[model samples]
Target: MRRHGWRWVLIGVLGLLVTGCFAPSGPRFGDGSAVPEEVSRVRLPVRPGPDGTWVVNSPGEGLLGQGRVLVRRAGPDRRGWRLALPAEFALTSQRPGSAHSAFVGDHSVVLVGGREGRRGPSEIAGLDLTNGRLAWRLRVAPDSRVFSYDEGATVLVADCRAGSCRLTGVSYPTGRRVWSRTAPGAVKVLDGCRADAFVADPVVGRAPCHPYLVTRDRVSLLDMADGRLYERPGLRIPPGGIDRITENHGRITLATAPAKGSCRATVVSESGGDGAQDLGWRYTFVWDQPQAPRDPATGCRWDRTLPLTVVRSLVLPDAEGALVLDPYLGLRKQLRRLAPGEYLTADETRVEVVHASGRPDRPLHPTRTPLRPPGLSPAARFLTRLLWQDGRRLVLLDHQNRPLWEAASACRAFMGDGEGPGVSLTYCDGPDLVTVRPAWKD
Candidate 1:
């Protein structure tokens, strides 16, 4: 007994040494009393747009609201334009595949959704982003929903009653019908084209790809120029209902949960808001080859553990922060808790807390050691230079992996169009929408 006790004591001390040497420790700033000088915050008089989709990419534009108001970047005076949405006409929140309800295109901003509850048909209206002038309005099917908008084409999938669905492609500037396709049963759209709507920046490192139409039976690649379907036999949807689908680094991952059991899928309000239901999770099947998806990694989870991508790796939430999982769903690393809850998202350079319905923000950053991609050893996943917010703190980390500036922030949730430092962050503090800008000396 004495010998075994000594051996366990030695193991405990070694574990402490390993963690003490590598755990990321830094100063936690703020008493929530005063705002820092280096951090610039501009408050607009409006509620935040949508819940889970807050992505801002331009410096000139700042806040967008579900009430259909677009407040431009504020000068010192906090004066900005307010384009009021029609009375009782609330904007739609982000749905699966679609990044934002107010899809901001190059030539126009397409707003989808109609009157709050008297739902017969939804309206898709195109407006000038700067002036908020209604260019054209098209009434879609009662079951209409925005799937995605890429380049000048905005795809809407509707008429999903029974088993048949229709896909309509609308032009961004003109609101004219480009093309339409019909498929049997409920259809899922996967971003297969070089589209900037689902990404952080539209210009940098953005490449072209094809769009795919997925059904319960088969997968079809979409032609963005026109509504042509190219069926792909390489990938196939696994048995059971699909829960969530995520794509990163040219690979697709599909999450499926049991439909009829104690662990069946459950819908809960993420922000505790009315009429907004966020589906929460189980098995993950990753597919990269021109063949079917691999065997699923099976696990039953109750708490919301949405698939988040960081450094091109699949990250799932844990108690501390998140877990970087390998292609085979093996634990790689445990990231530090930067925000509240498990709601986090990331892009190439930055990671931010994502919130829905005014929930507490959760922080997501690595703690102990740098994470590398699967099968790669020497190369490391690095957050070289980033400006991100965790609940109430805004941190600007420099190239040397040092905090350039940390300040007490009012940004409970960050509203962004995508990821990265250049992405504009808009959030709601009480009744006012706040946009945060870091006053960097560079």
Candidate 2:
């Protein structure tokens, strides 16, 4: 009887080993299929610091406070500069005061409006990040608003009044004025080219005026060293006006509105001549909806009319400019339209229940998901925010929107807590983690 029991045990051990080898272990939710774990946190220690650590902080109050700005090392050096603000400064909600409108770079965090009680015109102040000191301040016309940042040369573009706008480049260390230029009309800086700045000359009119009628806007290339205009030429368009301009990989894509309705997009190579040779290709959208192209080469599809309310925000991925449709108030459906071929790629898109202020019987589904991790119980899932896409990977988060793990390129899942079924199981290898916050319970 002892020999027979020994044989049975050996057989069981062999079977277990083979199973482990063939079927890797991964997070298994209520659904039998293995769901990729959430990446609770990502720690990218490449920035070379005191153990390569960083922190994310938002001011406590007002417009400048609400903007979510990230500051990190400007380069690989430990003592290198860092940037604080992003390009856009608009507030999500209509707060009482001005919104957060600056990017921190190298030695300075650029501010839009003047100081709290200082009665003066709107100014761009470079605040020292190391000691929170004001390094330099440039007074902009009270009617002007500093909008965009040029990372190449650390230049800023502001919309000033009196048919004139200013483009100023400031030195990072001493905050001394490097160079400044005033344009012919009230030009809103659209995007930056290679050492050049693109501006949109707004038509002189009221709130709902046509933007195209005010043509003759110039795409001027400025020498970073001397702030001299390299090329300033008039770009002629058809009867319709330009609706929007998007920049990617040093190329400017002009989305032009149709005379009657709808819009078409044209890709202009920034390096080419200011004349007709600069126009690379033009694409027209058949439908009137704001649909971004799936791929950069193919452009957007205007034919397919999606229900207007179904779409939330359109994100153009990286320099390739592939458009990802973020649907907020609909059956969870995330769609990506590739350019060139105009092909559609669909991944996992599901709406999980989340809990906020209401009771379990009738929970609230907020449009914006709160940050959390994933793999909470049914009750906990209510308080969790669903992890969308991180770069190219799709992730699942917990109730507090903390990443549990992420599946990359449809394979190879990386978990945060280091618990999952996969071969490449490594902690702190997911999206570049700048900071880690305390997890919240459902």
Q: How many residue pairs clash in each candidate?
A: 20, 41
Error of 2 at 84 (Å): 17
What are the per-residue Cα lDDT tens digits for candidate 1 across 253-351? 454443333233311112112332122123332212111122244333332223334434444443333444542232223333323233445433344
Model 2: per-residue Cα lDDT over 1-442, one tens digit each: 9999999999999999999898954334322233343333434422222321222222111012233333332222223233334333221222111233444333334555544444332555555655434566666555443433323235344444556566665664555667787766644443331112222211122111111112235544445445566443434332344445433333334444332332344322232345634334444433322234443233434422121111123332212333433322111344444333222221223232222223231111244542223433332212113534444354555444555545443222222221332211222344343222223222
TM-score of each: 0.54, 0.40
Q: Which stretches of candidate 1 lie above 4 Å from their native place?
A: 1-63, 66-68, 74-80, 88-100, 105-107, 118-121, 150-152, 184-211, 248-250, 262-305, 308-310, 315-324, 328-409, 412-442
Superposition TM-score, candidate 2 onto the true structure: 0.40
Q: Local error of candidate 1 at 283, Å?
A: 7.3
- Cα shift from native, residue 265, model 1 (Å): 10
Scored by Cα lDDT, where does model 2 land?
A: 0.36
Model 2 / residue 113 / CA error / Å: 2.2
Best by lDDT: 1
